[model samples]
Target chain A: MERLSPRIRPVWLTAAIVQAAVSGGLLVGGAVGLTRATDLADAVGLAESTVVQGAIALAVVLAVVRLALAWLRYSVWRFELREDALYIERGVLTRVKTVVPFVRVQHVDSQRGPVERAVGLATVVVYTAGSRSADVAIPGLRPDRAEDLREELRRLAIESEGEDAV
Target chain B: MSRLHPVTALTKTLGYAVQWASVPFFLVSILSGAFDVVRIDWVFSLAPVGFLLGAAYGLVEYYRFEYELSEDTFDLASGVFSRRDREIPFRRVQNVDVSRGIVQRLLGLAVVSIETAGGGDTEATLRYVGEGEANWLQREIRRLTAENDEIEADEQEGLEPDPTERPEPATAGTSGDRRPTHLFELDQVELGLLSLTTAKLSASMVVAVVTAFGGDAALGLVLSLARPFGGPAQLAGASPLEYAALALSSALYGAVATYLVGVVYTFVGYYGFRIGEAGDDLVYERGLLQRYSGSIPTEKIQTLSIVENPLQRAIGYAGLRIETAGYGPDGGGNQSAIPLAKRSRVERFVARATGIESGDFDRPPTVARRRYLVRYSVIAAAIVAAAGAAGIVWGLPYWYASALAVLGAPVGAHLRWTNLGYDLREDHLLVREGFWRRRTHVVPYYRLQTVSTRRSVFQRRLGLASLVIDTASSRTFVRGTPTIHDLSLSTARSIHADCRERLEDARRTRAREERALSVAFT
Candidate 1:
């Protein structure tokens, strides 16, 4: 279980890159405008070029720091299915735990987007009768693993219902 | 059971023609105004003459409409010069809603709207019938349909019971007597509590006020209070205290007006509120100033819900709304048979009417956690913070505004979310949701016509999906729950599968039991 999955690293890397690009754009725009409006470059006893370079470096460093934090956030997410319920634990610093019983299940749906399909993976969604936010979806499962899990859960849910196993 | 009076169509046609004639009259008025601009004085005189002609045409059309009843079918004929005929089989008629408008009250006529399950635009209507005749027709239709169903059941069993022997009441197990069961009736206290909880009254009052006083006045008054710091000078130099006094007085006046309108509307809408069992059907008759009578077959009612608003919770009152199949103006086109009743009473009623057992669940439905408060507050807080920050940056006083926002937004959100809940029992699924006017719907396992599951990308990441259940009731047609998930995908699939299997099992068991009974009797 401790063995690192190469695919997982790329997923986090891609997300971090996207976040960095957005944050970088905003920070650069703000710093550049501030530099253009103020005479601080001359008053600071530093060349304007040196001040501009410093500002750009500071913004890049900030974006990189934020991206590293996000990478750590996604790494902690984990899910497991037990005999009676499905369990999920996820968080960066504040942990969240969720348990959904088999009997409360209403319907199940499987979905795959371009990214997931490219990775030969699929997501399974579970719905209950009353709770909208309580619904959960599990993604990044290999096709075979997802199908096997679906079958196993279906069996467990039917047995738990104790009436019809259609 | 008796037939409807033949004058229904004529009265209805007269009403329809009068309504249609208004368009042409308005168009002619505009045309006359245009002509007057060019000094055509004679054209203006034609307006009144046109009105008279339109009224005369309506009267002629009214007399031409007529309908007759036969043993298994009802026939209607209408149209002045060109005759249009409609034939409706008794079995196809889903429900009969009899209502009386102001005109009907004056003329001593009742209007009957006949609905059917088949997907067709044609609906049979009988206008200008005596109230007594309308009631008789309703009973006749119900009796005929019930008799047909019993015969069909007997045929399926290959044995027919004697017609002389009375069939057992549907609620025989719960209620001792065979007399039609009255499920629940709202007393004065229950009615008052219901009025306090629901905004139906206040919403209607707002509509009435806006219509009476132009929208501009309403908007101006609202804007003045919302941005009070804009100063008295902004409101034409009125002193702060004077403006405050005016606002307070106006609010007091509005509140009084709202209360009166609410009481009157409630009295009319739910007057003589009654829910009773008649054969294999449930009947609802209400309205004070105008009467509305409708009936739903037990088999056709797809879902039943008992809902409680905050006010109702304090007073122990809950509203029961039924969802049925077929297309009506409202969703699922199921009518509210008993709009308001005590929660305890509604629970007892559901247990008695349907064979399913009823009790409080070990856990409230998960949707209660997703209540309106949590969802709305999250959005409201973000929006308000952003707005407050922008306002402060723009040199506006933000403290007072932010304080007011903080006080109201979260409370409103929580109230909305707290009222939402859903429970999936062994035999039925119940959904309770509403912010101001709460409603709960109970849907039986067998009556579910379709089940669907959906998921968005974010939901997929969280391992969540939404499930929708559709029934035949028109009332629940628009009120179907969009997102109900507390289970995993496989679990949901199994639940759907189980429900379908159980439904089949019940059908087979009933058939086998009927067969065994018939064989033994023979």
Candidate 2:
């Protein structure tokens, strides 16, 4: 069993906050604009200021909930590198556990997105011959660790090539 | 190094130029303020010049593309601006097909499509090869794939090649003595039945044609014609008698048109359809206009499917499909081994071809039925309520009549639940599902790529989960994955574990079989 780098928390939180903030800004702007352009505040029996403030509150609540979910998601995510296969346990609402055999590995790649690069973290993706679960990605690893994992999986896959997993 | 038939360059260049003609049109439109500043006639004239430039680019592309067959790999290198090289191992090759269209026939050329494992579609298309050369290449590729396996086996056993025993490629005798052990060709009666039944599909095509040309106005006319039987004739105040006559005439016309379309499509597709077994491979050839012939190696098969629609089921007829890891030339990952045949015969054929028993399936627990009932009933209720609301809003008469459909919800749920079953036999796993069009899938244990159990929030509340069985076949992703739904959580977990363990055993069995076969060949 393995855990992701602890530094991924900040990246996840930042992404969640940015996503929520943009939608919140749009909502607040739309609410304020609607009050000035139409009679929405009057129809809802609320003052213009109250409507705008309500929108702000809703946006803040949504952001907080999203942050909580992200934390929970991080806690639940884990992977295991077995002798013959790789197993992953993930998801919060609709839980999913996947098993990818070593011999099925078609290729492997290690990537560093802008956010991950800033945090000195990387992600490794393992591709398989299967159609649906074709690509499996493990994020939030130190760059050196991600490379090691990629090399190890590649070697293991080559060694087990005689098994004809495809 | 090998060069393709010289005419291939011409055909490819022409196709490339014609396809690229659109780019200049868009560019001109954008530059000329959407053709306002530029004269329409002038723009039209400029298209020819675009074609000329595109032809030049096409020539470069044709010259750049190159392919060669090596001892163990098929190498391809193609690019105009940058170099891209790929080497596909022979053992990974799944299917090799040769096809020809009218234009290719006129040119005395054919296309060779080679598909490999994990290759999305036709991995390589050697377009416009001489007809005789295409056939030779097809047979040669198969020989190389077989030889690759033997070489690997020998290498593992540390055996040196005996030059005296192994024949030279140039002198290898090509004979036609390898005839099919079992063969099936669609008869006239079966073809007629297939055409008539499949016209139901083309009925949708008739509707689409009506929609494309007639649009909403024609639909309204049809609706008015249909109104006498559907409800009161209020939309069109014409006399009921005249409307009923028009409705009958249009209905007859629709049926005839649908039947004609269906017959043409079916006949054209399945004309001279023949499937035969030549050694360990299933060879198929079909089509009236554009001919297609391919071979599917038995061991490369991922699963076998037996499909029966309502009409076919009533007549004891079924269709058989073989799924593989990669797509064929036409991008149909699943090959229709038999479009229509007797159910019993198809079953026997599949069993013989795949060498696996189609065992009886075990039904899910009764509680799963309750869950399906609840889920389907809820969906039916939602649809009814929405229709009722829409009816009232649109001032439709008898708004409450939609409620009648909700009562039939239990029937739908029962059919769905009854059809859902799975069997984990000794050698293979069987999953039978689908109510409208029943499909029974026989997946050998070795082809079970991954086994997973998923639980949604709703499933958790109902103490149920779904077990998904994945293969390397591409159809598993596009269509519904072969999932056994509404199993009790415990049952799902146990089945998942059992399936994984069986998969391990199957792998060992596969290795042993390959070893034995190699030894026998040696």
Candidate 3:
């Protein structure tokens, strides 16, 4: 299988970092509010350092885990286009392998989140018929490659449309 | 094509009255506490007036409902204030089911439910038609579908009917010349056997139903009733042998009671169960008090599953099930093809359903795969061992539980490894697996939407792979996707390649057929 583009590393890392920042920021903010408001702290029966240290530890753990996951995801994300189907493999802990046949493809679209756009990457989403978990997304492709893949899939799908009703 | 039976008005009114009955109980409960509600019965009596109003409304609604059949479509128009009209084409209809409940039976009426291609519950349900009228309507729809096919075929051959040539109405005389062949039917003995073997987890259901009807006090009553007979050891210092015999007899009594209950249930639900094939459709009829009849077209069937539970296998019998599009939990359709029959009978049924020669599925799984299963079981045993050790250290003496894992792991691994099997025919694929409920899924290549060989980190190290074959019918719980797991990498690869080629061939032939039909029509 062909590996996804190397630039995907940075795109994934940016997403993970943003996600960690939001959650970590919430915990730290809550801890700081508890520490500064002594009356509230006294009512809850907690000291300032305990809350502050726990929040810091949680933030550090989240940062470390998210960064490691991003790298692992980038390494594992791969896809290949066969004659009649597309194969995809991704996930760090629970690896998921998905296959989408051209005959069953209903539609395809290229999506770009703000972070992906900033990193000059796009994700192509393939919607299939008759399955709840059949949608396959190929992320971290350059815009041109994504467009090319989408058009090729569309053509293959049209060619096979007469055979399968869905 | 007309309005439903006249008694339908009464049934609809009764349904509405049931909903309104709760109001009186709620009002009485609320007012009995603070106010002297017992002194003023009229305050609690208003709910009857609500029922009367609902009954009057139902009469008007029943008067507004109407339906008619055109040459090519079934038209239903119903509503009291806002008129709604629906026209379903004959070509789009998939299966037609006729059902009757106790109330409908008393009124000599039935409910006809029509399901179409898309999974939208029921495309249309014509409620409470005369029993004879419901059967007539079902046959009429099937005849129309057949004629529509013939007309399309003729049109494709450049023999399009002139504008002056009006389509002929399907009458009793001109539907089909094909006679229906009697396929299978369950006798009293077979029905009893089926019931005895059926898995019933209905003890909880029995408890719940009794509680619902009798309130919380009934639970304690039931427990007290059973207490004397349930515990043989507690019955005054008896001999060990006597205690064991009592326990065995009680268990036997419970089993017999449960079996008798199941027999009654099956006898009522599956009375006169019969399957007959006419032309390209299979018709099934069953049930006693509430009868049901359904017709499924042969082409709509996606897969044929032959299943055998441990008991059924021991008795040399199996169950046959067929999956059609939109026929499952979401579709509100029944999928029972055959409840249970001898193995030979099942093979014949399979041959007839698929139009293929009788095939065998006796392939054994590989030894290497068994090793992997044993290794996985060992890891689980290790975890249990660690937990048991920890329990022992904590002074709970729970390490004895570890013996269960030590013994059960090997048996489970062996059953799983031995049960796995797959057979790839030229035009079809058969996958048989499961230890408790052995199932063989026969899928034609044309039905397959995707076939992928997957390998995980563990499989990679072992040089093993698994094949997943998916079809559109995966939307249903009864028709699951067939997966052939734990094969050598080379074998999996070859199977994948073979499946791909067969799928391509099926698609090409399908395209050619469509092209030929289109050309003939033009």
Candidate 4:
């Protein structure tokens, strides 16, 4: 099995931070809106300090948990290229092992998101001729490595053209 | 080059008129204050005109419809106003199915549905053609495909360094007079048994009758019958014994009626079921009123499914169904390759269909995976206990139902535990599963598109794994993915690896054949 780029940890951390920020903002914004619209603090018979402190503590704990899970997920994500197939093994709670045969692969491509671009990492996607769950993505690769993997897979797929993929 | 049978226009016209009648119904409902606040009566008069227009359109569409069969391609041109033409090469044609509805049967015509390797519904349907013509077309197409393969082989030999040597043993040894081989057929007694064992006899009808008149209508019926002499007051004063007797009789009546209806339906559907092999095509002819005949090239078969219900299993009988690429799209198309046969006969059919001998798949499956069975039964028992406790608390008689669960759990577990098995032969993998309706799927290694292993949260705890194998055929998805569940992790891993290796080998051989052909052509 091959491990992805080490830079992926920070990229995952950035994504987790963004997710935590958005969720925290939504929670606080919702509380503030309720208070303004209906005097929620007074109606609930609670002091403003109590409500604000509870929200802050909740957000902080959630953000910490999210960051930890992101790191764990980054560690578990791995992929390998075999002689006749490509295998991707990932997941934190429920592990998933996917294998796509070279003959069954329809195409391969590399994509980079904004954060991935900043972190100088790329993801390679393999589309297969399966009836369901037809595509698998192997993320957290250097752009050059991702490109090379894609090209190699494309050549293998072309060489196995007359094989019955179905 | 020719049109459909003259009777086709009548059937198509009726179909179109019925489809378009909805428009008139919508207009009438809206304008007559049936659905909204309006009161225009003139639109009611337009209903007749709408029907007439629909019929006219159907006639025009029928007139424009045309099909032409050339040497290597079948072309169809249809549509009333916006014409569309479709041409399918003989190589692309997968299977040809002939079905007849009541009207078509009455007119001595059949609907010929042409399927292709491209999935979805049949590529084209030549509706209401003479039955003989439909059979001829199917046979002609099969012959053409065979000839096409022969031409490719001959060209390859011409280009070979030594023309005398034939490399393919399978094709070389069997180039004799192509004759139809009678495989199996259902006799009167076997057909009766099969119809009796078929699961879910008119389930929809049972549901409909129960929902329609089960409660109030049943009570009213009892009361009305009782009121013939003394009216409602006397019936209200009836003894408890009388009510119990009435309920018992009604239940008996319902069950008997349901059984009779189911038997009649099964008989009609599979009256004269027969299956045979003609050259390279497997043919099926069956049905009582609306007889159907269909043929599928053996090369197009994706998987072989041997199905049996509990009753059939008890009597040592099974049904055979084969899945091709374009069959069973959106729950339509003929999927029945054989209606019913003895277990040994069905096994023979599987051998013929897969080219794997019966002895190869005779190895008993691993039985140590019964831990999954115990786990499932334990969960079921827990549910039963919980529900029974809740029912007791709520003052309901739950023991009657819980008794069923208690009896069912062990029986189900025993059946599944014993039946579930997987055997890997030289060229194919057979996975047998199901408790009441046992089905064994015979999938060729070359037909496998994907093979995966899944470990659920519970399976992980038990250190067990499941193998899910998928092919291109759609019927596999309908019956649930062909899976061999509950094996040790190491064993599952080894099996997965073995399948992958075999798949690679199959692909290499196919590629080599294609390369040889390409070199010959160039």
Clashing pairs in 4: none
Compared with the true structure, what per-residue lDDT tens digits does model 2 show for residues B122-186? 78888768999888777777777767765664564444245433322321112212564447888
Model 3 residue A16 CA deviation (Å) reads 8.7
**Native contacts matched by each model:** 0.00, 0.72, 0.28, 0.33
Model 3 TM-score on chain A: 0.84
Give model 3's DockQ, 2 decimals: 0.20
Tell me each candidate's TM-score: 0.61, 0.82, 0.73, 0.74
lDDT of 1 by residue, A43-136 (tens): 5556777777777798789777766766664566577776556665544533444445565455566777776776577767765432232336
Q: What DockQ class does candidate 4 belong to?
A: incorrect
Write candidate 4's Cα lDDT for B1-522 as tens digits: 879998878867877776677687777677677655554665566666777888888888889999988877889999988899988877666778788878777667888888875445678898878977887777787777656655654565565556345544334213212555566677898889977876554555774576467787766765555443333433466654455445455555556667766777778878888877666566777889877777776666777788888888788888887776665422433367667888888777566545555633332234433564576678778878776654554343434466556566666666676777788986788888887777888877777776777776667777777777867665535455588777788888998899988876765454343333222211
Give candidate 2 regions above 4 Å deviation. A13-69, A158-161, B1-10, B16-41, B157-180, B199-263, B329-332, B476-480, B514-522
| Residue B480's lDDT in candidate 4 | 50
DockQ-based ranking: 2, 4, 3, 1
Better of 2 and 4 by TM-score: 2
Model 1 chain B: lowest-lDDT 10 consecutive positions: B169-178
lDDT of 2 by residue, A1-166 (tens): 7988889889988998898989989989998999999987875567999999999999899888888877777887788888888787777777777777776777889999999999999999988767766437898899999999999999988876555667
Candidate 1 CAPRI grade: incorrect
Candidate 4 chain B worst ten-residue window by lDDT: B513-522
